[model samples]
Target: MILVTGATGRIGSEAVRLLAGRDLPTRALVRDTSRVPKDGAWSGVEVAVGDFDRPHTLDQAMRGVGTLLLISPSVPGQEIAVIDSAVRQGVQHVVKITNHKATPDSPVDRRRDHARIEAHLRASGLRYTLLGPNLLMQNLFAVAPMIKQTHGFVMSAGEGRFGMVDARDVSASAAAVAAAPAGHVGRTYLLTGPELITYADVAAELTHALGQEIEYRRITPEQHREAMVQAGLPEPVAASNAQVFGLIAEGDAAWLSDDVASLTGTSPRGLRAFVTDHVDAFR
Candidate 1:
């Protein structure tokens, strides 16, 4: 049996679908089971209730589960405790979804937390596979309103390009690793989209897809910080988001890698395709 945490989320749901399509007996963990899409109809999955804040519930979720996919919780500091619970429940292996740039040497506060989680996984003696996925193209949806209103995309990412994989691609790569019989244990996969794209480039695609003039507006990282603050995000989260955007602006996320295609046996989707599919959101 396989258990997927955060199964209702974008990437998680995609992972669940892929796992089920592969005929794996899958159980999804969501805070509300009602939110899980109809099995094999909407997204090909079934769900059970599990909350990260409530570790006791996890043991029930883990019963007979040999492998667990631990989706990083939105509540940042809760991973260690939740992982510990899964370990105690006799889960033989775990696949962790983590940020791409996270490393032990990373000084950024958020990446450091993921690094610590990786360390814990290493020391726990459980078989583990780490998926460090790059920036998600779905994040561009946050500018949907701006695209609809002004036909423009705005970002703190100036000249920096990102090999931003679609969330579905990330999900597919993750499911592949989770299903591996061996060879992936203790391995880390750095996943990216098939192409490197900049904000200006994305805007160009959106322009064509939406049949309107679209432009890229570059802002300072400080401006990004302020914008997040005004959006009602907590100070720390806003600052951390700004820091990650800073990494993108610095060209740290630009290199296109074939890890997604290699792992999933299919080319990851491109920015143009992503925009075209979700054009209604921008319209």
Candidate 2:
């Protein structure tokens, strides 16, 4: 059995769908049973109510699970205990979702946390695959309201081009790794889209997709943090998000890779296609 954590999230949900589509015995670890879909692609998958904070629930969730898709929770430092549980439960392989810029000296706090998780997973002695994806295209959905209201989105990433990947593609890669763990063990894949595009380019794509003049409004990091806080994000999370944008503005995330295509046997989706698929959000 394959166990998927963060099963209700973007990447985890898609991974569960893909794996189940391939007839794999998949189990989803969800905190809230109500969040799991009752029908559609998720109809037949097993749902286990579990939490990383509550380690006792994990043993039941992980029982008979050989391969684990270890998607770290958004809360920091939660993955350490989750990995320990996986190790204790005798999970043979772990496919971890990490950041593309994760490293020991990463400037962003989130990336640093991912680096720590990667380190812990490495030392756990289980076969593992680390998927480090670049900026997610789904992140643009957060600014959909701003675009609908004023035909513009706000950001601090000025003239910095980063390979923005679709979350679905990352899920596809994860599914592939989970199904066939032989070739992927002990590998770190840097998943990215085919092109590197700046926020200005993204605005142009949105303009064309929505048939309106969409703009990318540049702001300072402090201003971005304040705007995020106004949008209901916590002050610390908003500051951390703004710092990531600052890193992007400094060209830290400006790169492309073929790892997505290599793993999933298909090219990653571009921004224009992503905008078209999510045109309703912008409208």
Candidate 3:
């Protein structure tokens, strides 16, 4: 059986859906039964109520699981705890979700944490595959209100290009790997969309899809941090957001790969399609 942590989350939920649809033995590792979705994708999937912080619960959840879909909140110890449990359970493989920019020296705390988890997973002696995806298009939803109100969005990444992928494609890739993990073990794939684009490109796509002119207002990193803080983000989180955005200006995300299509057998969606699919969020 494939046990999925963060089964209620965007990527994990979709992965579970795909696995269930394929008649794979699937179990969702949620913190409680109340968190289980009533969606049809969960029709025959087992529900294991457990918490990552609690090891005994994880051991119970892993009673007969073989493959693990490790999708956590990117917290420090959560994934490590799960990895330890997976080791004890003699799981055959793990499909971990990580960041494309993850590195030991990344300025972004989350990416650094992902790198740390990856290192630990690698040392755990378990067969593993890492899916490191670029910036997900769903991130734009955070600025939906601003776009609806002003016909524009604000960011610190002025003219920076990045391959922003759709979250569904990442989840689909994960499901594809988990369904037949032996073929993917020991591989690290950098998942990305088809093209490199800037926030200006995003705005143009939004304008064409919405039939209204949308603007992308560039701001200094400090200004972006201040704006985020004013919008109620914690000071440290706002600063971190600004820091990552600033990295885009340095072309940190101006890379592309065909890993998504290679895994899912279909091309990932582009910005124009993403904008059209989510235009209601902006409207």
lDDT of each: 0.82, 0.90, 0.92
Candidate 2 ranges with C-alpha deviation above 4 Å: 74-76
Candidate 3 wrongly placed segments (more than 4 Å): 32-34
**Cα shift from native, residue 159, model 2 (Å):** 0.5
Residue-pair clash count for candidate 2:
0
Superposed Cα deviation of residue 73, candidate 3 (Å)? 1.5
Candidates ranked by TM-score: 2, 3, 1
Winner by TM-score: 2
- Write the residue-wise lDDT of candidate 3 on 1-283 in tens digits: 9999999988888888889999999999998777677656699999999999999999999989999999998886989999999999999899999988789998899899999999999999999999999898989999999999999999999998999999889899999999999899899998889999999998999899889999999999999999999999999889988999999998999999999999999999998888888889898
Question: What does each candidate score in C-alpha RMSD?
Answer: 1.7, 1.1, 1.4
Q: Which stretches of candidate 1 lie above 4 Å from their native place?
A: 42-44, 74-76
Q: Estimate each model's TM-score.
A: 0.95, 0.97, 0.96
Better of 1 and 3 by lDDT: 3
Q: What is the lDDT ranking, best to worst?
A: 3, 2, 1
Please give the range of 10 consecutive residues that has the lowest summed lDDT in model 3.
Answer: 32-41
